[model samples]
Target: MKGFRFGSTQGAFYILPGHGGWEATYGNETLGEFSSPQQAADEVARGLTCPHLSEVDTSTLEIPEKLSDWEIVHV
Candidate 1:
């Protein structure tokens, strides 16, 4: 699975693969993982408490279209 990075320098946001689907990581630690991008975004929106966060910036990683729906398992 592909990922995206959001937020600012104080603590950037990350969306990656988790056991069930995708995961969100902030700074150097993981916040949570979910089954879809919307789910992951919701988790970050509800959970993040970063002080320097004014807005979340999101950029999609280059991933093959064929593998877009594949589940990413954290190893």
Candidate 2:
């Protein structure tokens, strides 16, 4: 349940999981999936030109103990 923020390859920017696996969100939100953590990170980086991507500290985010109970739809 790692979190990384980046821009989209085409348009929008997003905060997504760093691992290429199942991602869960709060309030039954359906976040997308990725083939790998790097892929996901790359997607984030593509859309955003934010310096925060390079400077922001992502180590403080707390991983969830379990998958979200809300419905999850594939991205």
Candidate 3:
């Protein structure tokens, strides 16, 4: 469904609609669920600030970055 996908040289993650709120997912595991998209994205953003995610240094993309990292979470 609808979600947000953003990343840097580190890695990428998703903030998709979950059971009753939002879910932050990396390579495989669903890190956690939050009551709002911003919370989920913030959580993923925290992990993105780290050295690595799921112990894998990735980001195969070599193109220019996005104009903005933020997304329309609601409305």
Candidate 4:
């Protein structure tokens, strides 16, 4: 079965299709199960406290060697 991952410096959380619904996990540990992929991804984002992030200092930001730092990897 193919699924996607949200990776970080710490590790990665995988969102995959499972019995009856979608599953969000960090390695062998289950984060939660949801009825849709968006919910599963939202749960993980909520856990990471993304809403409270401070604004970045774009003045110092430089272009990455990659066109975009983000990617969608199916595993």
Candidate 5:
């Protein structure tokens, strides 16, 4: 289960199914607990710039390191 990757500073994150909720993690480090996977992903993505977010079953998401210099579209 891979997560979004935005350059080196923005490390990998994941949303895993837990007992009553989902767990958001950065590598082996647990970031927080959420009620749903979408919430987890949104939370993580909120902390970074133009993160290439993906689902748990999806492949690793990659974004150009120079994303900060490019214009990003939000929707």
Candidate 6:
């Protein structure tokens, strides 16, 4: 399973596509809107001691299947 997972080692705090424009979030709480997903992920990495949660952006990651549910259905 591959996907973009955000937040610290505590748990998934946010998602990228949902926020867009490199917005970082924790649940409904918007942590901060970064210029890029990498930046947002970096900030999280600095905050947390975990490396897995730090890497973000074009970097290889698995896209969660659940996100498909939120995708816009093109007619």
TM-score of each: 0.53, 0.28, 0.58, 0.61, 0.48, 0.46
lDDT (tens digit, per residue) of candidate 2 on 1-75: 444333223222333453547332222333445665454444333332234334332222232222231123334
Per-residue lDDT over 31-65 for candidate 1, one digit per residue giving the tens place of the 0 to 100 score: 66678766776656555543334443322322222
What ranges in model 3 sit over 4 Å off?
47-68, 71-75
> What lDDT does the true structure give each of the candidates?
0.54, 0.35, 0.57, 0.55, 0.48, 0.46
RMSD of each: 7.5, 11.1, 6.3, 8.4, 11.7, 9.5
For model 5, residues 11-71, the per-residue Cα lDDT tens digits are 5445666668876665566667888766666665555323233333222234232324223
Candidate 1 whole-model C-alpha lDDT, 0 to 1: 0.54
Which is the leading candidate under lDDT? 3
Stretches of candidate 5 exceeding 4 Å from the true structure: 1-10, 48-75
Best by TM-score: 4
Query: Between 1 and 2, whose TM-score is larger?
Result: 1
Off by over 4 Å in 1: 49-75
Query: Model 6, 3: alpha-carbon shift in Å?
Result: 7.6
Candidate 1 residue pairs in clash (backbone atoms < 3 Å): none
Q: Order candidates by TM-score, high to low.
A: 4, 3, 1, 5, 6, 2
Instruction: Please identify model 4 stretches exceeding 4 Å from their true place.
Output: 48-75
Whole-model lDDT, candidate 4?
A: 0.55
Clashing pairs in 2: 6-44, 7-44, 7-47, 7-48, 8-47
lDDT of 6 at 59: 28
